[model samples]
Target: MLARHHDPIAAIATAPGRGAVGIVRVSGHGLAPFVQALLGRALRPREAHYLPFPDAQGQPIDRGLALFFPAPHSYTGEDVLELQAHGGPVVLQLLLARCLEAAQGTAGAAGTAASVLPHLRLAAPGEFTERAFLNGKIDLAQAEAIADLIDASTAAAARSAGRSLSGAFSEEIHGLRDALVHLRMLVEATLDFPEEEIDFLRKADARGQLSKLQHMLATVMQRAQQGALLREGIKAVIAGQPNAGKSSLLNALAGAELAIVTPIAGTTRDKVQQTIQIEGVPLHVIDTAGLRDSSDEVEKIGIARAWEEIAAADAVLFLHDLTRQNQPDYVAADAAIAHTLAERLPPGVPVIDVWNKTDAAPGVQPGSAPGHEAVRLSARTGEGLDTLRHLLLEAAGWQPAAEGLYIARARHTEALRAVDAHLMEAAAQLESSGPALDLLAEELRLAQNALGAITGEFGADDLLGVIFSSFCIGK
Candidate 1:
């Protein structure tokens, strides 16, 4: 347990900027003394008291609403006080300073109560939410959902995070755990009564239960993969020869002139990145320097960086200039780049062949040709862009879930995979000629532990620290 939980923590909860209102929040045990010292009166629990927030000199610093939530009923399961004031940065800072002063007995004799509010300090990042987790107000997954909701980049992602925060994900995990516990009980009972094991095991249907659990686990794992994609968008690298309309496609997809485009072969000498959403699935489009031999030292460096990006990308779009495809030199160059891409790109990373400038090269058909699967589109005229969008989603193996998804992280997906692996091992044990109940029971236990880790029911302190530290303070 963290010792700082005993200390009172205060911070400016609202974002730092000029707004109609700002809030200074404090959380700890027994905040009545501090509240009385700051507001000059006791506040009714769960009630908003419109009053003057006075300073040490009994001067009204700013009049705003003061809301108080008593212990066991507040966000952190402690006494939490929120002072809403003007959103000016200085005003919030002054209010925060006064809060610290009042908590530390820095005011006059009337405010001296060190025992009531001892060790008043600033909160670390996510300490407030961490306290809520520790106090059982929310579990670890829900706490993570709090941060995910705030950082959501899309409407779909925000909704998913909201669902997860509402304990949708935790409830599912708990339900699965309960089922595992029931199975474990049955298996262990058989071990204790070997004489009656045959009839007991037959009636218990351990194999059938395990199969059902495995199926359910697979379903959850699939949903988690989609949620993880929403949280961490796919990185797609655009690579091709110089003047292949890579920048043009980026600008068209983004619906803005984000990247400078020109007819010059080496116009884009560096990577130009733009994130665009197709059906709430973010595609981080990286338009890299065109691949080709160049005497310009800077262009060579850019080309090298482009290859590096391609190697790390989840997908690569090899754009081809349709107008120049008939030329022998251009064809040879395109073939050479294609050969290099096949050799250099990481295995399993999909590469999409895109023929650009379809408007200039009319009568050219789109779709799979002799050598590659291609999508022909005119980035300038906005033709065949929708097909490319669908293709990108398909290449990433993204299938739109029929039901709502709970926002999940990479770690959640990894844990689910671990659980699946253990379940597979357990299934293999059950199918053996002489089924080993001992080994099957151990495998189920391992699976339970892996699933529990998702909700912090069986997680290390270091894992909790890493998760919470990523959140902003006052959460």
Candidate 2:
């Protein structure tokens, strides 16, 4: 896989389909000659030139702007060429094909493109960004952020991804790494002089330094956890008995009539989904079919699917009808749902009691179930929704947004956790009655390695492949 990184790659850099403009990009070592060969004229470095990209027969494939960036200064630390042309698919394809033909020593009407760059081929998905990472132009974190920024579901997510791309997250990792290195050096120096090992670490304030490092890691972990929430929002499933205002709550939360709401029971025969953001944290709220024992075959299927969704939910909003509190049958059905919730809900998925239609039953004190948050709201009047939104965010484990936050992934949080554990081990070793300098040193080393993995300072080729393979072609 590493050997494949050396191959020159070309790709259409724009999103698929028609647009006002599209881009065809190529990156490789010593591409200046290739640029001249393909364009029939040498391009000024880092300058855009108006030109017509010619084919093997020298006919214009598309007239557009071509820009060149020389090696060690480009995105991949290699020579790069970009052609901005009309966004039509066929026009970009012809230009790309011409570049390939020219790479194979095919001569156009004006000049020969032979041997300028050999073995030119189509870029694999994320190959372009992967090269940038491998070449040290951007670290692994920043490379991942490129995709994150593109796939961001909210403005906050996009901003955080941009911060990460600008190396905000990498900078934090580097800071932790530098501190760890200093502490490692101090411990190793102490190990070298066994006669005064304890006293040496003692005078150097190594414990104090380690304490500071742990504190720093904690801050990063908290920020990364919140950022991961932005990247990966939780699934929130709304469920209850028929006419319990399940669809009404969903519509109210989504601020649109997404789910069909009626006085009739089983109006929603399927799930209605909407992605709503609370403080820039996305929640994929799904209103599943009401749960009940239905004789109709179709209603039974819907109810079964509702259980499926309930089992899979990150948190279940078991909405209860406030007006039906006095009805004995309604109470039993609600209890049945609570039992199924306990039986089927994945462990750790919170079950919140949402008392709907509070406007009709003002000041109704619905009995709160022992392990679930109770919220009273009138979905029709849009009251108590703010409280529900806050509770949902709380249930998702999202903290208040921190300043200078950067988007992070699940792997990042896991890596940080590993670093924290290693640091804790090192601290314990330091605090031991007869601390083994070697164990302390080893723990610190592992912690640094974990930190290095976050920014590509330490990682395997397979890890690199998995990270970059997730990106779209042409970065």
Candidate 3:
């Protein structure tokens, strides 16, 4: 990715569709000649000029707005040219080709035999934002937040991503790193004067500082977990016997006829999925085929696939048919399925016991049963759905923070966990009868590195490649 940074890049910045207007963005150093060849005159910096975008034959391709931003003040911290033209796809493609041709012609007119400007090519995914990071305009976390904001599925997630893009997450990480650095400085100083009789850490109350830092890191980790839930969402599988209203529950939650619901048993021969948000947290709900022994080959395959989805789910909604609970066969089948669920589900994955068809069975109360946390509801009538939604949030360990949250990814949570682990080791080192200051300092340094990686202060080229490549081109 770094090797191509020196080359000028261009791409259609807008989404691939017809709209009122489209944009073609060019970014790199020394774009004055290319701008002149395309626009026929130098554009005023930061001023919008109505001009004709020309082709290789000096004919107007489209008349629209032309804006130029000089180096150090633009998004990439380099010279940038934006051409707003008609939104037709073909028109945008032609304008893009004309820009490249103009670059080639401009280089030839300047008599530069070995010029790289003529080699201007289409920008790869996320090249513009990568340049912004390289130019120190934004950190790695903020760059990721830009992509998150664009891809957010819910209002809360979008707001959190916006906060992250504004550097809220980076600022918290930086504050933790600064505290670790301060402690490291004190510990390193103690090592330098080992002959001194006075204890530097004890005099400076380093242990107290370490305690406070641990508390702060825990707080950040909690918020990061909630942010991750908002970003990645929860995968919930609706599992139960045949005709337990799993499909109806999915449709009710989604507020659309996303899944086919009927009285016929085994209507769903495969997994039907939909994503819905409850209180601004996305819930990826999958209504799988009924779990049962079947003679039909296709139904058998679907039943097998249902188990696969159940195993991978973050939460499982075990819907029971309240009207059929009195039947001997139904009771036996429910017990067998419950045993399978206990054996197959991963440890720590929660299962919510839901009794459906309550509209037909009004005498049954909606509360916990013996040795089970249960919610009785009618999927057909939408009764007790509010309780189910709140229960889902509680099972996922989601807590609304007093302050606004910043969107975070799984990698961010892992990094925070690493920092917390190192801090724990440092505290243990301090508690030893004869404190090992060297080990303490090493833990502090490790903690700082893990924390710094969140904001790109400590990262590798390959990691950057993986992070930025997920972004849309021309971002």
Please state the error at residue 60 of candidate 1 in Å.
1.3
TM-score of candidate 3 against the unseen true structure: 0.95
**Residue 449: error of model 2 in Å?**
1.7
lDDT of 2 by residue, 11-54 (tens): 99999899989999999887877887888899888888998988
Instruction: Give Cα distance to truth, residue 25, candidate 2, Å.
Output: 0.4
Best by lDDT: 2
Better of 1 and 2 by lDDT: 2
TM-score of structure candidate 2: 0.94
- Residue-by-residue lDDT tens digits, candidate 3, 1-475: 4568988999999999899999999999999877876776889899999988776666677899999999999999989999999998999999998777777764343223233367689999999999999999999999999999999999999999999999999999988988889988988899988765137788899999999999989989988998999999999899999999999999998899998888999999999999999888999999999998899999999999999999999899999998887789987898899899889998988889999988999886544334455788899999999999888988988885436899999999999999999999999998887878888889999999999889998988999999989988878
By summed lDDT, the worst window of 10 consecutive residues in model 1 runs over 364-373
Clashing pairs in 3: none
Between candidates 1 and 2, name the one with more favorable TM-score.
Answer: 1
Model 3 lDDT, residue 259, Cα? 87
Using lDDT as the yardstick, the better of models 2 and 3 is: 2
For each candidate, give its TM-score against the true structure: 0.95, 0.94, 0.95
